[model samples]
Target: MEAPVYTALAERWQDQAGLARLAERAERRLREHPHGDLTRWRDALSRLPPVEPSADLDRPDPRLGATAPDLQGLGETLMDLHPWRKGPLVLGGIRIDTEWRSDWKWERVTPYIDLGGARVLDIGCGNGYFGLRMLGAGAELVVGVDPTLLFVMQYLVCRHFGGDLPNYVLPLGIEDLPEGLGGWDAVFSMGVLYHRRNPMRHLRRLRRLLKTGGTLVLETLVLPISRPGDLLVPDGRYARMRNVWAIPGTDRLLGWVNEAGFENARLVDMRPTTTSEQRSTPWMTFESLEQALEPGDGSRTIEGLPAPVRAVIVATA
Candidate 1:
């Protein structure tokens, strides 16, 4: 029932008392053979009896355009969805962006969100690195929502590592945004909105989930300026990419945040990511700074701005 119990029962049948007996026996056997396989040395662990799997793990909400994010049957689901990260795909000429690990995501990003003693919502929390970190750092409550099986499976692993047993990790999306969802102090979404078909719709939905004066912290790709006007995400966008709209400039981003019923919209930082990197790494995929900004051309998106294809936006609700 408890988180540790699952891992323990699944692997270690030796109880505390059994451990003591094993230790005593090992001490006695030390003179005979001190260094061999531990499995050879210990009393065998008995198999744990199986229990029925939770039906809720596979439950789907009605409105999400995609299927309920499958928390069950995830091993294969993840392999299919995350094909970029492994296997025979590696031998082909194709490259996968592998730089998802970051100096910022672990250290700077989580702390800046500041979830301590606060109710927090992490939209599309893939692998939930922030949720685990927030719980370890003392969040009063933390809820992570994501649409991919890979993200949910990783979240389940991370939660157990944080010590609380899971009730469930529900699959959810912008279309299924819960009613009466306010009263949270903060909402954090990073690198996820762009994947949606309607990013502005996703922005507006954040307002439904935040308390008055709550903050939304986001990191995303923005379009570099070609001239005085806004740039459209060129016409032939990928098929599975439903929305993939690129906010033309920081001004447009700030405008959207304000329109979404938020004040104090601001651009916090800018940096180059894997957008242009050869796609060997699984995580580093992004709208590369070079291609996005075309920095070499001495180009500016508008009259005053230097081209920064990606930007971080932090706004108050």
Candidate 2:
């Protein structure tokens, strides 16, 4: 076996279920969608507004069976150590253990990607794990943009770990994004779209970043159908940590994305990373495990939703 892709982070995470936006079953449904007449959703992709990606989806990993990431690199517990892709990918900066990669970060978003020779952009690239993963898979140029100083610091940390070595670059904000850059093969606005100051407008930028056929992947929380909600105003603390707004449901959210300049986009996956009510804590990040609610490290907390409670989409421009 070529080792797991995100195993390192999986091991270090003290919290097994702090986040709930992305889940595994979504991957299952995505891969098997064709065989099961899930074509309604599958066909929706072609109907989405055509935007050609200036880049390309990273190549699929030979290790993981489907679209899932084999993140076995995240171990070794050195917050500073970067995970590098071995033979298939020549990435070596920060090493990521499966513990870290298996978290909601990789779970929800890693499945629908093909990053070789594509111009990739990671909004709110946090510690830069996902972007690094894209680069390892073969994205020619992976640009990670974030508003925080920690973004730079974490890039350093990832670099210290060789996480920054692959074809990757970290910039400040979208405004800082290099101009004349044609567009992206794909854009992963993952944990940030819901938290934006003006989500619709921000989404337009994401769409604009892609050519007519590019994929725009999004992941966020959703409200139950019974409880229709327009927004999910997080407690002040959560807002302060992320510094943006959040919605309670996926319908309104997806509706807005379509309104911004998309068509036929559909909800493809919904998984519950955790069901904790502690949205007000910093630990609420994908890295937290308040959901497990157990002492000691590596315990897991799970939610009992028949379908994934979180929602993900591969909307097109």
Best by TM-score: 1
Error of 1 at 214 (Å): 1.0
Error of 1 at 143 (Å): 0.9
Model 2 lDDT per residue over 1-317, tens place: 21222223213222433111111222222343334333432232223222221212243211211211322322222222222211121122222232232234454566666666776667766656566567657766555665544334334433432421433324346654434343567887766665667777788888887768888887765655555455656555341244536655777877887887866687878655452322222112244434333333212223222222457877777
**Clashes in candidate 1: how many?**
16
Model 1, position 69, has a per-residue lDDT of 33
TM-score of each: 0.57, 0.56
- After superposing candidate 1 on the true structure, give the runs of residues whose Cα lies further than 4 Å from its correct spot: 1-98, 106-112, 165-169, 225-228, 238-243, 275-308
lDDT of 1 by residue, 51-86 (tens): 222211111110111122333343232233342321
Where does candidate 2 stray beyond 4 Å?
Answer: 1-104, 160-166, 169-171, 178-180, 234-244, 275-309
> For model 1, what is the alpha-carbon lDDT of residue 201?
79
Give the whole-model CA lDDT for all candidates, comma-separated.
0.47, 0.48
Lowest lDDT sum, 10 consecutive residues, model 2, at: 18-27
